[model samples]
Target: MFRFLRSLVLPEAACEEANNSSRYENLFKKLDLNEDGRVDIAELHAGLKALGIPLGKDAEEKIFKTGDSNKDGQLDFEEFMQYLKDHEKKMKLAFKSLDKNNDGKIEASEIVQSLKILGINISEQQAEKILKSIDADGTMSVDWNEWRDHFLFNPATDIEEIIRYWKHSTVLDIGDSLTIPDEFTEEEKKSGQWWRQLLSGGVAGAVSRTGTAPLDRLKVMMQVHSSKSNKMNISSGLKQMVKEGGVRSLWRGNGVNVIKIAPETAIKFWAYEQYKKIFANEDGKIGTIERFVSGSLAGATAQTSIYPMEVLKTRLAVGKTGQYSGMFDCAKKIFKREGLKAFYKGYVPNILGIIPYAGIDLAVYEALKTAWLDHYASDSANPGVFVLLGCGTVSSTCGQLASYPLALIRTRMQAQALLEGAPQLNMVGLFQRIIANEGILGLYRGIGPNFMKVLPAVSISYVVYEKMKQNLGLA
Candidate 1:
């Protein structure tokens, strides 16, 4: 009769479990360590310890006093469950608050601010801890789905899908060499991803640039240092480097850059090829509009991955007074002081210019190459190094002319970030300052040396890349 009455008042599941060999009652009795018919602070501490919960004495006291009604200093099963639900609710609220920008994603910046609010001032170690906490997907950025599924939705379900998406979105892909194969399928003949062909043409640029990162680093250091000291010419800069820092200093940061360059090139080039292929017909030919689209996307892809490395290389190459030791040290300090996103400084214009730069570069290169082939007899072999050099030289001149303005902006933005009180220069601010201080011509300040370096670099690079491609049957 008592069991029936209890079942009528309490939940069926709870009541059934309670009377099942008195196990539930035994648990409750164990919790009520003093047999006082309620859980007091001391009894709650003992119960929590037995359950292996790490509730410190203060926490145990707080929970016991809060949950215990009528000064009983103890909790029944219902009280225990209610307390758990409350704790879960508080945790859910806290997690939701961390999702700043309300974009269903929480970035590291948001995590840092949220930590400050929680009275947990983060050091490098603490920041790393918080980053580990929020970056559940493990790709760095904390997206909304990751946050929701991790803390709010399903804590136990495998989060591979969320992480996979994060990886896909964040890290850039350098497409396959044959992605915009010389031929296309019948279905592709209809659906127009032809722009992809042009974009994929960036593969060549990526390949070419990837090989010359050492020289590129030298060039950046030279430009940054020279421009600041009014030593504007490339020859002058090279001379100064040999005179002051020695030739070895010219190749500083080359080691770390090697690993980055190839992948960066592959991604940009693949994207350009894909874009171009989309716009072109089966013949792999494109018009002006297709050219623009392909070039833009290709430039953007290459710049994004390489930007951080570019920044590091610049710092390393320009280390005249021991500001930094090496690329890794520079990267570490930047990440610790400013965080990871600083690596992508000046990403905007750099990416924006990539398309036109790539388009014009590839277009001119192919056009010149074709013209040279025409110069040869029909059955004659294709152009040799001199002809290849001429074609590459022309292509680079055109690309540099088109890209110099944006390049100037990018350099200023990257360099200024290293300055003490240098007003944080955005693309707009840089553009405006360049125009105001140096006039429109100032935008092309580095164009002369840029052209000089680009010509030889492209000449050598294309020859190597084409030869490699041909030898490998990738062409």
Candidate 2:
């Protein structure tokens, strides 16, 4: 808070002495750029900027609000000093909490243990990453001076506030649906915001899937039926579907697709948290590798649990009109004709796809976000909605590109039994056959339609999610 401001303003005025009025007066005069008796937000911003501290508009406003004791939109010297004293006390308490051993310094172990108490487990290495940011010197630890200096401009009032500031990210549902669900802060969970956010995301996904139902259906049809003998491009594919089943048939499988969002998201989120804990290193930290593993496992766990719905969706999408009445009817027919095992025909390829999809999606997203921050953070810490969506779309497309072959194979296997004269091939056999019969490009049969849906799906999802978040009081 303002405590760090005093240190930056008057470096030699650290002592709490009543006779230090001259030093305080000098500091106040320096900040009062207009030669007025008070300092306003503009002056404060200019002062911080002069010191090479680039703070966001929100942070600057927050400081003004906190220090303007009389709500006069400015801080007189007395008000400024009072705010600094109060902030100093809070900062000291926070530092003490992290300095668990009372050694007057915050180390990696201390950060790890402290965060663990708050249900945030981190390995010592990850803790070191945090320390390195705040530890001005190469000592790899934070003393009172370094801590105060690092947070001088940050308006976080407590340790939890500081952690929250660092941990929060703008999570956008712009990528492959199979990617891991967004994480919620402990505060969000306790305050019931987590469910609201999840609900918003769920509604967004449902609408997105519905809006792109025709394209999704076409993608499935091409993946299962397209061959060297039967070429299927987007224009021809759409015409065929309309001719065969009429316009309404394009939404055949959309019911189950929308219905699975809630449970799949819930299971993925729960499994992700559990897997992260399991894969954490001995120091209680999860690194890049651990996160990738956890996310992939979480996706697989969710996909496995709800895989029957997937098979049903593919069946319904490829089914002609009157083939199945609804989701229940589709399930009944699949169960009656092919037995329980039929629901998991393409399980291997589906699960295998999760690894490449989740890994590449996460890695690319992180890389893009990191690069964006490195380049643009000096101008603004918050990467606006457009930037986030762009990164997510690019990362998702990359992931889809890498995993589309497996996905196509899985779809073919799922529908093989239903297609007339189709061979019931296992995962590997299907791959071999596709390559041999249709050539290497055959593995990417439905990718055109799949890629075509990415932009529209993401745009619809983001717009709907934003509207829903506002309605839910989450924005």
Task: Give each model a TM-score.
Answer: 0.47, 0.73
Roughly what TM-score does model 2 have, to 2 decimal places? 0.73
Compose the digit string of candidate 2's lDDT tens values, residues 146-179.
7765675577677777765333233445325567
Question: Ten-residue segment with the worst summed lDDT in candidate 1?
Answer: 164-173
Give lDDT per model, in order. 0.53, 0.78
Best-fitting candidate, measured by TM-score?
2
Per-residue lDDT over 41-89 for candidate 1, one digit per residue giving the tens place of the 0 to 100 score: 6776676466433354434555655556565656776675566446446
**Candidate 1 runs further than 4 Å off:** 1-218, 225-229, 242-244, 269-295, 366-389, 458-475
Q: If candidate 2 were superposed on the true structure by all CA atoms, what would the RMSD be? A: 6.8
Off by over 4 Å in 2: 1-171, 281-284, 380-384
